[model samples]
Target: MSGGAMLSLDGVHAVYGRKIRALRGVSLEVRAGEVVALIGNNGAGKTTLMKTIAGLLAPEKGRVTFQGRALSGLPPHEVMRMGLSLVPEGRRIFPRLTVMENLEMGAYSRAHGAELAREYEHVFTLFPVLGRRRAQLGGTLSGGEQQMLAMGRALMAAPKLLMLDEPSMGLAPVVVDKIFEIIARINQEGVTVLLVEQNARRALKAAARAYVLETGEIVSAGDSASLLRDPAVQKAYLGL
Candidate 1:
């Protein structure tokens, strides 16, 4: 991994409506080529953090910097253009679209040419099942397959940083394992990952460094091994 911050959130605070605070002075960094995990319970603002970083929600306070440029006021499309892509929670794939069409939607920013074709081939290689089901509607696939399609669509964008939120949610244990394996492969292929997952044990195992977020704030932060061994973390998150 490179010794530089690929994405950084400095004292970011966000709210909903008018007074509902979702994040409080949340600050963290994801270095290039590293898989960083953010683990927390439901209602801990994990999704909020993902959306905030993706430019889906502008922070009320603090700064978001990506690739050394400020991202505070940039729109979501602009953020994607800058090499940041988010595969949001719940595997939000278009049910009506064919697998190939969904993947095409992801590369909307790219020119329709050889490069785009190569991207499709790349995603197909990553998930061979997607290639087989290219003509099938996304909704017709199994849950696990839909998840793969969502990830493949994101890969079509060829992002430098890929942020995944709860990619393992609602899947069988075997499917979850496959998802993590793909995540590792993606990291090895050089996309820095910022992951938010509820499966604490799995998330810790997958990430190099991790931050424990609780009640809209960071309660702990360290390398995965250290956090896994932490007594408090074990009792509350790891079920040890």
Candidate 2:
């Protein structure tokens, strides 16, 4: 495919426990300032794919290139510094740490502490509730708040591409809607996004382009508008 893609994975393969194959020659991409959603049912290797791109998991075969730079062996922290960040499946915040402290952790990789602080202000603007409860421990926040905190933390890293896995997994409809709204706003502000969501209706609506994954491979790919109208997609995801 095109080397100009913001994030690209070519023939990536990964295994778990030296037995189970999680991804098999999977290749995908998310361009700068675009939102690409990866949708699939349970055990479709969606999360595994995101982990590979985020550097949380290494590919046993093939390669990942972010902005044309190879990212085969880089650790997760190193990847974050390269303007890529993942919100992960769960909130994954520190129970003992205050919300502000968690946000600080996102910026630890950046040398400019003061610049990160300014970026923190932008995060607060996006999720004012986080600023309102900055003193509260992350563990004490509600599920929706925790999701917001997770997003805020990723923003603190000042990423060019933000990868979120199952961000709306277990939230209320209202909360899920708000989270998606924030995602759209973030994209409008110029940060590219790669999102994995169980809520296909919400994800496809929010994304510019989308891919349908079955097992470890892509079954269909297209723009969000077309995907929404696809008969197979409607039957499987849209309930139409």
Best-fitting candidate, scored by lDDT: 1
lDDT of all predictions: 0.93, 0.90
Model 1 TM-score, all chains together: 0.97
TM per candidate: 0.97, 0.96
lDDT string, candidate 2, 1-240, tens digits: 865699988899988566879888888888888999999998889988988888888899999999889998899888888999999998798879999999999888777767876898999999999999999999999999999999999998888999999999889999998999999999999999999987898899999899998888888999999999999999998888
Residue pairs in collision within model 2? none
Candidate 1 C-alpha lDDT tens digits along 1-240 = 244888999999998567889999999999999999999999899999999998999999999999899998788999998999999898899999999999999998887889888889888888999999999999999989999999999998899999999999999999999999999999999999999999999999999999999988999999999999999999999888
Error of model 1, residue 64, in angstroms:
0.4
Looking at candidate 2, what is the lDDT of residue 117?
67
**Candidate 2, residue 25: CA error in Å?**
1.2
